[model samples]
Target: MSEAVKEAVAEPALVAIMEQLPKTEVPARSPLAHHTEVLSRPTHENPGVRLWENALRTHLALRGDAGSADFARGVEAATGLALPERLQCHQSGEWALSWVAPDEWLLTGPGDQALAMEMSLREELDGHYAVINLSGGQTMLRLSGPKARLVLMKSCPYDVHDRHFPVGKVVTTVLAKSQATIRRVGEEDWELVVRRSFADYVWRWLVDASQEYRLSLGHPE
Candidate 1:
């Protein structure tokens, strides 16, 4: 094949590997939009537990060979954050990369940056890898306050004690009968990524379970 023809054929294949985000005018909605009233309720002066929806943030499921140095460097180059170790999380400013499994990781950032971020990853990465957008199908909730750990204790069987699940640790576990990718962000702060279908059930379950500890709606950050 001629050099020009060979280049033309390979270029399309490279570009075709990525699925671009559709441009649309539809407004993004949070899974908990119907709970505006409850979320807007006044918080107690001494509330022990607080909850808020992270809402509409970009979620990308990444799969590749973790052992490959090229893949790791490409990810770090595109994301500005290193691929996290097993059950760990690495964050930089608003971006976070969390280890989900042996070959899978989750990358989340500002809602509006999905397309640009995906493009960057596609451009930098080569060979066998995948980046699938999961934003529209899932939402994140931020749970914090003095009793946040207690609320998690009641919701999941995972050992969330500080010593075991310290800051920057991530785990996928059973939460209130639903599954959640839970990340410990701080001493009292946690981030839970849950599917849209189970968001309502999980939110209400947390609210009810937190009643004893004085649950309150936290201001969205």
Candidate 2:
């Protein structure tokens, strides 16, 4: 037998999987929990910019060979959604899988299901791949209203025009001074996934930028 083949048989990769969330119930708080007053206040009638938090949802960073049939099938088997093409996003029920890079995607679902989802992916996937639970390190925010596009224009250097950034398009770009995975969900609705540490900075930046547009804080649905 070839030495290369012998070496491959002698050594195997080790993968460690663990539950990222606490086993016991614990009070969960979002990055903006301390800004309750600011988020709960009223705004002008027919406010032009409405904001809210998706908060604490499970975020999984998935990496695999998009060109492989096994990779694609395994992802669909584990996620129940197709692998999104470049700069695209696919949603099935409460789960959304978005393409973040050539070989990377972001999968988000109910907050409590991070471990289950991660396990399922590990079970179905083979070969070199990675699934990381980022639920505790980042959060999602929703921004919608007539002036939402304008707000995005002020924040991101990327052209957010309707033609350039159609619905279901995902782009990781600069937001204020931090970076955000921005997705266009609807005509005027957008979702921003930011790091937990930068959540406050992004929120405050949006608030100040939307001042002239009459900002309103909406309850998450």
Candidate 3:
């Protein structure tokens, strides 16, 4: 056998598996679709907490070596956002990257761009790295307003004070009876990423917790 033929046969074939969005015009339903009626209600004056589901967004669970320069550069090249530090989040344009653990990060962006983003990352990253599509398994909710911290305090044991959970920080903690990856996007605004199964429960729990200060539902920002 010729050396040229052996070399060509030794190279592994690249396999690309792309996830496609539904092609039909059928409307996509959110995990909290059943509560649409309540969410569509008018906001009350001086509401303390404004809540809404940031539905249908792309969520990718990324696992890679953060210490590798190639990994960092490749991710930034693909998403245009730096990989966040421990318990932190970095946002650029429509995308956000949150640190989930020492070697894992979460990447989120517009729903329609998930496939493209994943493909880009796969192409840029080399060696041992993984990118898993988590868009279908989780849902994101936004909580904001004056008493948003109070609502968080009521639900989790984590000290949500600005000094502790400052803006741009992300923490995976217990939220009510479930777990959520909470990100402090602003001084008064928070974003919670929860499993689809626990989304309804978490939403109701938060709404009830905000009742003392007046709760209202609004479109996600």
Candidate 4:
């Protein structure tokens, strides 16, 4: 092999494939459709609605140099997904991209694609970058309906008005006692990005706050 080729091959890969730990099987409980609160439960007072709860899909942190054009393009080329511009989302049919930060974005796709998508990103990306499948580190919940805005306003401070937050806006804003990357999926459908550790707090806060509105919590699974 040429010296240049040897040098290239000698360097270790930039992103590591974080091992896939065995999935936890949450015990099934009584079906309470009204307790839309399951999404936030911490697994004792109420139970966490695991991956089996919803048909929706999600991927975790994609970290890279935000200033690298090649990194941005690599993501687009890798997943047929593009990084959202600023605090907005890019949706084509069912899939959407939400900017989580200057160097990261969240990919929402089918549940089955969660792992495969991360692999594709790993293979497609070049240079120094990282794509760790953090699906386990956080949970995504859908709080949507005619009253979704009113319900969200109870905790979030972002201007949820259609004029300020159009249908495609995404933001990292304060949520209850924690923080969230909130995105608008539709007029009535909103997505919340919350840490797994704080799931209980988020669920209880939402349930108590939305009780006055008769909000319905659901997974539609």
**lDDT (Cα atoms) of all candidates against the true structure:** 0.90, 0.92, 0.90, 0.69
TM-score of each: 0.90, 0.92, 0.91, 0.76
Clashing residue pairs for model 1 = none
The candidate 4 region of ten consecutive residues with least summed lDDT is 44-53
Q: Give candidate 3's error at residue 196 in angstroms.
A: 0.5
Question: TM-score-based ranking, best first?
Answer: 2, 3, 1, 4
Say which candidate scores most in TM-score: 2
Mark the regions of model 2 whose C-alpha exceeds 4 Å error after superposition: 1-12, 23-25
Candidates 2 and 4, the one with greater TM-score: 2
**Model 4 / residue 57 / CA error / Å:** 3.7
The C-alpha RMSD in Å for every predicted model, in order, reads 3.7, 2.5, 3.4, 6.8
Question: What local lDDT does model 1 show for residue 60?
Answer: 93
User: What global local distance difference test value does model 4 have?
Assistant: 0.69
| Per-residue lDDT of model 2, residues 110-204, tens digit only | 99899999999998999989999899899999999999999999999999999999999999999999999999999989999999999999999
- The top-ranked prediction according to lDDT is 2
TM-score of 4: 0.76
Backbone atom clashes (below 3 Å) for every candidate:
0, 0, 0, 2
2 versus 3: better TM-score goes to: 2
Query: Which pairs of residues clash in candidate 4, taking residues 3 or more apart in a chain or in different chains?
Result: 36-217, 40-203
Question: Can you write out model 1's per-residue Cα lDDT over 108-173, one digit (the tens) per residue?
Answer: 999888988988998899999999989889999999999999999999999999889999999999
